[model samples]
Target: MESARIPFTERYHATQHGGIARAANSSVTCKTAAGRTATPCAAVQQGGAGANGHYRMAYIDVDSDARTANSSSATLRIPAGSRVSYARLYWGGSLRGSGQKAAKDNGRVLLAEPGGRYRQVRADTMTGHRPHSATEGFQASAEVTELVRNSGGGAYTVAQINMATGHSTAGVWGGWTLVAAYENKKQPLRRIALWDGFQSLGADRRELSVRLPGLRIPANSHGLAGVVAYDGDRGHGNDTLTVRAGQHRAHTVRDTANPANDVMNSTVTDLGRPTMRWPAYRNTLGFDSDVFDITPALRSGGDRLTFRFTTTRNPGYLLGALFVQTDTRR
Candidate 1:
């Protein structure tokens, strides 16, 4: 289900990851790379190389404490003196290894603020889900406005995400996203919106578009756009995310980390650079949480902004969310 819009006056930021490769049987074994060691998921790309000269990629729990269930951390950067308007936590992955009753428990997760301990958080509304299959799967989310408001920006950890450990043909993948909108009087007036759902882009649907209407934009305006999707293979062509302001020409969104032709290529970054997160991965295997600046496209302003996501390939992709913050007239 789609979420209700915020006031449309806030700016936002986020943090996320592609899950870690489980090295052993225990969920604890997968967390050796947390906190202290800047272990890039690249180091453990495969269980070990084989005669075929190929490596297998998988996922594991990345929580800091093995004694606990599951967890992973990411840095949420917010400017000082800004108040958090709204914050939402999103977690999803392949359900095969996510264990029993994943659908029932998908609504609840444990979250720890910077310099804090874990606490229960529940989804206030909808969850996008699908049974374990050859394609990517479900996503669950909860509002964390108060938790993050007080915690402020830093390293925030999420536990009990219900993502599976190990690998498969579909791939063992999972991750978390914390989207926070803030009120910074010091910043420019902008239209910030977050649109989300669990939808496929293979056989069933080839494209999905999210529209934001009744907007005031300035000429040569600048802004940012981002998406959270799954099951996209790196180097896959014909997958693109395009944005257009009203009747203006549509511009394909891309960055150094994401190519113009392959927006779903699995990776996590801020405008193309790697972000700080445990089990940090340069290649998310089949998961993606990427952002792109849409400045050039907004040069000719209009009243409505439409974002079109298209993926023309096999095995498909699952979309979780899309966030946009564009410059606007006061």
Candidate 2:
């Protein structure tokens, strides 16, 4: 089969203009587990010389309609048979308060879905904590690929906030942003590609392999396409990278110049100097880009599909990210 080029398209969604308060009203008041509630932005001083400090807390409720009734919802609707390649949440905002030193607080944003399913989208110990007295700015983000996949095209009812501490001195205010990338075409149920986050590969961990999760393929897939971004190589000679499925050897990856033996129409991109170094190497090295096809070895056996890789030399190549495209039976 001819090689296929899979391109990714991206879109961003965000809440209405103005702060979180304007987006949705605080329906539920903040209360401690012991049923203790403090006035909003009211500083509670702590006693003792060693404990020379104070904190505050408050709770805000983000209305479902207000949060999703914006341009971001445009990509929420996934075409039938198509899948989301990637989804992430980018959130940032300023906190209002009055204090000599900037107040610090930890909070969580909950994504409340239908059927009573609640997922904590963002959780951090220090958010919106600044040193300035009048106000402080902070930001937090997370990858929600799995969350988007599980949503099943249902809308999130609300983005709930939970303040663990320092709520009184600083009132939480921010906007929620959603960014998603989807496949352009409606892929068949059998043909799908799951992106696995960056996998670290080194001399100690030479072979990097991952099994496709939550996939039920009764028979062998028609073809397999694999794309990887790698950096930090130590070797100069031509090193061969092998792709395998179970015990079957699929494709051997080498310099893209040798296209005669390359069946996947593999391509490479050279990403100059290494910004960072792995433990094995103390100095920076060049990086390599690879995109290839491994259809020959992508057969299903024992109800599991696993991809493995091994290099001829210790290039010290760190596998940045991997995406596997294959066809399975419906």
Clashes of 2: 7
Model 1, stretches more than 4 Å misplaced?
1-64, 97-102
RMSD (Å) of each candidate, 1 decimal: 7.7, 19.4
lDDT of 1 by residue, 196-311 (tens): 76777777678877777777878888787767776676665789888999898999888887889887777778888777777565666666787777888888888888888887
TM-scores of all candidate predictions against the true structure: 0.81, 0.35
Residue 119 in model 1: lDDT? 90
In model 1, the worst 10-residue window by lDDT is: 17-26
> Which prediction has the highest TM-score against the true structure?
1
Q: Candidate 1 clashing pairs?
A: 63-71
Q: For candidate 2, lDDT tens digit of each residue in 1-330?
A: 101111221122111111100011111222222123422211211111110012232223333344432111111345555455566553433344222222232234555543445556653212323333222333344567677756644444335332122333323223333434455444434434434333333444556555554444444554433333322222233334455555454455433332323211112221111111111111111212233445455554223445555444442333323444445443
lDDT of 1 at 237: 72
Clashing pairs in 2: 13-72, 41-168, 56-166, 56-167, 56-168, 57-167, 57-168
